[model samples]
Target: MKFIHIDKENSIAFYQQIMSSIEKAIKEKKLLRNDKLPSVNKICIEHKISRDTVLLAYEKLKKKGVVKSIRAKGYYVRTEDFNFDERYFLLFDELNIFKEDLLNSFLKGLAGKVQVDTFFHHFDPAMFSKLISDNMGNYSKYIILAANVEGVESSIARLPKNDVYIIDQMRNSLKIYSGIYQNFVENIYTAMESVLDLLQKYNRYILIFPGHKEPYDMVTGFEKFCREHGKNYSVIPDLKNFKLRKGQVFLIPNDRQLVETIEKCNHHHLVIGEDIGIISYNETPLKKVVQNGITTLSTDFSEMGKKLAQMVLKNERKLIENKCTLNLRKSL
Candidate 1:
């Protein structure tokens, strides 16, 4: 490994400075294809920087196809020439099973003609702004999942309007942007209507909504459903210290809460689908087997990803609403 210099006083980010140094080496023929680079720990120790900084730099290099990593070994130069026809910046709130489906489908739809670098904000406003600002002008397109984050319109405004696409949840501030999103309010309200007959068996409807990580429209829809139907309902932050009783149907959005609710039911010796009911938000393969199949009202994530790909490929600017469906299983 060659000596790499990092300037701590410079305005450039530490990871970016490291990336620039490596790219400069490769361009100037100092680093060749198949050449092994210094280990992350070694770089961190030599430069007196955190391991995360070095790892971030290496990860970015790997994403750009300038390097590759071998299991139990280290990073190596993958190619001398670095060029991509269509580079994309994909930003998401977080990764889950349904989101993974969407991501895989989006990749499949691209057909190997595009390079996509994905990042997660995890619903942090500052991190969301930083990620967008850091990657501006570097990618051909930006696909963002603005999941209930406030004041992100300014960050998104920095990108080229024609090259940006929003996904998952769309806010009024982001209405000018073209993307695919779910109408959570309408979807939830309609889904409840579809299963109104089954819901009548329960005495009250309880929704476990930890608001920080969930869509507010879901709460609105739940409230609207109860109000219009004249059904007794209550919204709680979580299932913590809450007692589960018979004749109460629970609408759970987060999977962790769904599991907790099921366990609470079991602890009380209450049978699912009979004594207490459950309806989860997103559908996954595991959901089909958990508790003899948990019922779900979910949007078609795979379809959303495919539509997004189409919009990007054709340069179409349209606000498309992906469809949602209710899957009635034994849990309901």
Candidate 2:
């Protein structure tokens, strides 16, 4: 492998420059399929750059199906016939089963004309800022799941405003950007109202909301519902040290807490739906069978993903609220 000099004065990013160099080599028939690329350490030392810079470039190549990594051996050229219409930078907070559904829907809706590179920040504001800043001008589109993190507006503003689209939860500071988000406050309040009659059967409604992981607006919505309807409600951070009482309905967001709630109910020999009710946050295939179908208040993640793909395909700049539904199952 030839060592290309790292040009400090060039407008192009270091990783992108590396990517282009390799791509050019492949196109010119200089680098053939199954050719072993230089090791990350070799590239870093030769170019006087950090390991992460080389790794990022190589990772992008791998995502484009240009290279494949062999365990302990290093990366090898996978193919030279690389073709893609558009490249997308998808940034999510984390991946869950429901999120997997959303991602797959988005990919299917695009029909493989575009190549997507997905990354996760895990709700870290600093990491989110760094990822966005590092990949500033690489992709044609940037789809982000902003979650509820603060101090991200400035970082988001640094991107091409017209090319950015926010997904999942939307922050107020990022309102100017195109987004498909769940109206947490409204969704929860309205969902509760829809099941007002069933809720009246319970003695008290308890929302197990750990503010750090769960959205605060959900708390707001739950509070608003309880206040307007004059229902007895209490907000607890988690199910730690929680005791199950008969005729008490629980609203759980986290799956771990949901399991704990169900286990605790079983310990007390309390029957779900009749003795106590449960309303899970997001719906999944497992939720349909667990405890004989757990009721859920969930937004249409599939539709959200599809709409996001449409926005990217048509280059439409719009704010969309993906619809949410109350799935009343046996748990309710």
Candidate 3:
């Protein structure tokens, strides 16, 4: 790890400064690939800062593929690959159940020598632009899990035609080329209708747990449906605050949280949302957790992955404009 001074006075954050410096160092060959970074404790002592600072810097580098963390070891500078081949780039906002399902599905049936790069972030436009510039050309096709960006679509519009396809979350405005996008509105409505049906059987107040602040298709859809149906629903961030109403339905985001929450809900008879009714948006291990079988809105990740690979390999850009489908399950 290279020794350095992280600026704290600049409008840019201290962690961001650390990241910028590290990135520059990597670009200038100051930090060689596979070079182990300074340990969190060491960096904190050297910089006379907190562990959070080091963690933030490490996180940024990890996200950019500039650095990686070894289990039980510290962060290390990532070496760039010399050989280039046709690949499908998978960019995501975060790692969670939704992302897991997408990756599992997309990785399905992928055979051959091809590189897959998966980046996760809820990045600003500038950060995303940098990421695109840094990584886009390396892969033949860009499979983006759109996060919240101020003007992501417009920025993507400037990229080479047929290079980018989106899934689940859309980072920018909707106006770019053919790519996979989730029908958030419709999917949520479907999930909610299923919830309502189950609620009719066993009355309960529905409390919606949103993981983050970014706009979510399922959450929006749930909210809209609740409004239209006059069903009681509240969008709460934390489950501890949820007020359970007798016979009221709660539309929690994923099975884990739902399970955790329901367990705490005085053993309320909760329904797991899988693909069919009250389905969870991003499918993964939670599918098995819902003993009653999770009703989920599963993504065709494998199909999308294969299609994206074909687009890149065959130079079929028009297919980038495709929208994704929801795989329904039976929670509701």
Instruction: Identify the candidate with maximal lDDT.
Output: 1
What lDDT score is found at residue 281 in candidate 3?
43
Report the lDDT tens digits of candidate 1 across residue range 221-248.
9999999999899999998777888999
For model 1 the TM-score comes to 0.76
Better of 1 and 2 by TM-score: 2
Error of 3 at 332 (Å): 4.4
- Which segments of candidate 2 are over 4 A away from where they belong? 1-26, 29-82
The RMSD of every model to the true structure, in order and in angstroms, is 10.9, 8.2, 14.2
Worst 10 residues of 2 by lDDT: 1-10
**186-238: candidate 3 lDDT, tens digit per residue:** 76676556645454543434545555534565567777887888765666666
Better of 1 and 2 by lDDT: 1
Model 2's alpha-carbon lDDT is 0.87
Per-model TM-score on C-alpha atoms: 0.76, 0.77, 0.59
Better of 2 and 3 by lDDT: 2
61-95 in candidate 2: lDDT tens per residue? 86577877887899888887889845789999899
